[model samples]
Target chain A: MGNDALNVEHSSGHSAAVFRETQDSEQFRRLKRKHRGFVLPVTAACLLWYFTYVLLAGYAPDFMATPVFGRVNIGILLGLSQIVTTFAVTMIYVSYANKQLDPDAAAIRDRLETKEGVR
Target chain B: MLHLAVTAPAAPGDPVLNIAIFGLFVAITMVIVFRASRNNKTAADYYAAGRSFSGGQNGSAIAGDYLSAASFLGIVGAIAINGYDGFLYSIGFLVAWVVALLLVAELLRNTGKFTMADVLAFRLKQRPVRIAAAISTLVVCFFYLLAQMAGAGGLVALLLGINDRVGQSVVIAVVGALMILYVLVGGMKGTTWVQIIKAGLLIAGAGVMTIWVLAINGFNLSTLLDSAVETSGNPAILAPGLQYGLSDITRLDFLSLGLALVLGTAALPHVLMRFYTVPTAKEARKSVVWAIWLIGIFYLFTLVLGYGASALIGAERIAAAPGGANSAAPLLAFELGGSVLLGIISAIAFATILAVVAGLTITAAASFSHDIYASVVKKGNPAPGAEVKVARRTVVVIGIVAILGGIGANGQNVAFLVALAFAVAASANLPTIVYSLFWKNFTTQGALWSMYGGLASAIILISLSPVVSGGEKSMLQGVDFAVFPLSNPGIVSIPLAFFLGWLGSVLDKKKESLEKQTEMEVRSLTGVGAEKSVAH
Candidate 1:
């Protein structure tokens, strides 16, 4: 998969010639481009949420200390917030990758299958 | 009508509730250990969970091992007594997880098999490097184990009403026995499960305490602050600086401790080894994310427990106890939640010590058997099952040594001992690990120099610091020692380690073809290169 992506870049300028001579396909290029965005953003968002939680605890002690229930301090709320954040980030990433990135990567993968079939 | 104060005499009883709670905890642990033993077959199974844990499970175990007695109890106690300064350790510890997530977790998981020395000596062809790393690993683990054992003793004494020495001895014997079982029977599988279960119970208990604390404070920010301020004589309970006796310098020292905790957690031999229990690098990453949530929540509860201790139990009581501020959380449980809750909390504390110490013992054993004995002395090949037997034997020796250390250090402040361990770890181990991972020119010579330099410098600085030097019984009590101002050595040692590592790497760049070796090393570490090359 990585080899195909690298080859696509190397053959971009000679797309017409390469497409004719080699089993280079349009679907594979699009798929590789699509999946590239999935991992980086998901990782970044998770880290961001984590740091934000830390910063909030460090800076917003008063707001965090505000008890929502009898004796339930704000720190508990902030701490529990990480659970929500983790789930939220993870769910969003999985959904986004499934909906957006994986299909594209799969399409490119299918193109390889068809190319191999032709050969 | 004025009610005159009547002094109540100290009440003495059989502490039946405490005994029952402790007995139940032991029974449960034994069941788990015995069950784990059923699955123990190969040495790999004993040492690395047969390398089968998912990222999340290992992550929890990491959290379990990482959240020590000091973290679970001492931080809360410190916060209760010293206010925001005390909470700094939690923040530091949490940030260190971020370090683990980003840099060390996956890398170490990918590089090492059982011990950290395996990773350190992967590229370097030096017996001295492996020996040095093993020694450092043992030293750090022993100090950490001593702190945990002492904590266990304190917990037992507090709950069972036994004399401190008896409590210490019992904890030593029980933990030693349990750890030996963990190694001989379940191995990594048993240890990992113990850590996971303990982490769960610990967080759940802390969560319960947090809810209780908030409920007692009426869930009112203003009211909570007002009460804390009124009781504490410092209205700045809501703000960072509103607390007393906390100056800028002290705050920075607290921050240094925090940095040490976070970074130190990643460097800890036991905690780092937990990552290797998983099969793949991706799982290792996933487990860390899980650990982040567990650790973050536990630390958050610690903040509440700290404030709760001050607001409800009063700082005076916390200070008056034999353990001083460190006893605040346990004491608060006793006062607020009654004996039942106290019993549970104390049992959980005991479990915390046992789980952490068991992890430490296993790591120390691995270092001794795998790194020093098998790899260094025997040149990496030994008779079948011999290494495993040696590891089990080493566990007994290490456990005994830890007990003696715990006994010698009993009645001393645990927070100081833990902090010293962190300082030493941050100084000695972290630099070597980070340099080896990232720096291309990190030769065996560089690793050797950095490890010894950081170790020696941290020891000297700590000996000269106020924590040891200014004490009445200190060797340097009457002598003038110009160590750094802060009692903790993180600020000095961390930077010093980095400098030594960098300097050594730079000087040795010409001695070897570092770039070529580092390229191959990175490929192996990342699992990006060919598999056949990796086997070599």
Candidate 2:
């Protein structure tokens, strides 16, 4: 209800048409592809890694219990690695988004907002 | 369950010192909240703190909001008693941020205005989607509040040596009242400040204790573990299965709980609502990064503290304490620095409850006011200031309800309540949000089906699960209605909700308008039109 862009859609349909055009544009397609392409696989891989750890902790206690270093077993190491991987993935995504995603998004956003003068 | 009869050790620290520290914290946060609330004249200010918080600040608040007493006291206590099994929970909770950061945060920040409903209802039929989202939000908040409230009763009673039920109930009421005051006076702005302050104190307190614990063992983690092993007389604690490895059924239950904890964070309504307090999608991303680091580091501290507690105080004492495993951190504090340290840590724990409850209350209030009252009840045309007024009233109503519910649930094995809240959020909210954000073909019918069906299945399964009735530690005594084996319904309900969402969308012949979908997609991905609406 507070959205002028949505209100514009109901009133004139011009902004809606423009939105559809932008949605179909090659740049927008590229943006979506780049964003989802990185996010989806990374998400799947991280989740797979995490669930694998969970399962090992559940079903394979002996393997996890195999002492890796003094008093620290594979389970403790694996748990620590999950934390490491979380921080690693977060940093990777931040850099990736900063370099690969934001500029394209800003360009697309600026063009639309400038044309509509919604601000 | 047999451990319920174990009397707690003579009160660990000075109760007078604990009360003094608690009073000091309450007074300081109250002043900050009142000062911060001066600018809250509009609905946006009330709900989103005028989008004034930086990424790092919001990150601290997020960490504060996310790290309930359950994580601080509960996980540490778990590790103290159960060892490696307790560490699994920390891993699951930390890894959950990946899902939030990569999939939900930025796009949601771009698409929505106030609550999770704003994102889900963006391209769909607004009223139905908003109503459904509001219901799920309220339910999740209510359950989470119940857990915190029950924890508050047991925790404060244990600290102050109040053995009477009347004293515990009074403590719960006072917590509820303080929560109401924070939200009523500070709104999101005040609540966020409380969260920030609490997060700092919590992390700092944990960090000091962690260093102290490591120092006691000559800075050797292995030595600490060795001492813990010696003291507990169980090297099995160093390995998994001390808790969850007894049988295949418990193992499978661990898996279910893991599934819920990992997938649950992004869909949590209070957490989602925090994303709106930041200025941009990039800032939202930054906040998650900040939160992951702060929370991840905090959990790492919990691991040390847990091992330290087991090493110093021994597992038997922790398990036999008044609050059971939830007293591990406090006990460790008493061990390290006597009554003063114990007082400070206990006060931090108390602030943890107050801040978390305040966050939940404000979020639920916003949902009811913005989604249910303003959008649905007013038919999207309420007069100026009406929404904020409604939100204040809703906060009062929710506070009273939470007080009553907390008292009713006090002294019960309500740890399952928090897990149930996670299950509901993961099942009832996550699927629809993912579909709406990614799938252009998602419809109103699909949203309704996913939200309502997911909610119903989660509630139903929880009621029938061992957590509610059949088990020795269930909420109900001497009743054997539990047919479901897994305590958490997530492993079943999460996939079911996703399946129902896909099925409903596929079956619907009536599709949402393409123009609206385009607007949402463009707006969500690029942040266009979002700032125009959210800015002023």
DockQ of each: 0.07, 0.58
State interface RMSD in Å for all models: 11.0, 2.6
Model 1 over residues B383-456: C-alpha lDDT tens digits?
77788889888888887787777766655554466777777777788888877766667777778778888778
- What is the C-alpha lDDT profile of model 2 across B1-536, one tens digit per residue? 11234455666899989989999999999999999998889888999998878889999999999999999998998999999899888888999999999999999999887899989988888888889999999999999998998888888766887767898799899989999999999999999999999999999999999999999999988898899999999988887898999899899898888888888899999999999998888889999999999999999999999999999999888877888788889989999999999999999999999999999999999999999988888877778899999999999999999999888877788888899999999999999999998898898888889999889999999899988898878888899999998888999988898998999899999988887788788878888766422344
- Who wins the TM-score comparison? 2
| Candidate 2 ranges beyond 4 A from true positions | A1-14, B1-6, B532-536
Off by over 4 Å in 1: A1-119, B1-14, B164-171, B241-252, B472-482, B509-536
Q: Give TM-score, chain B, model 1.
A: 0.90
List pairs with backbone clashes in candidate 2. none
Each candidate's TM vs. the true structure?
0.79, 0.97
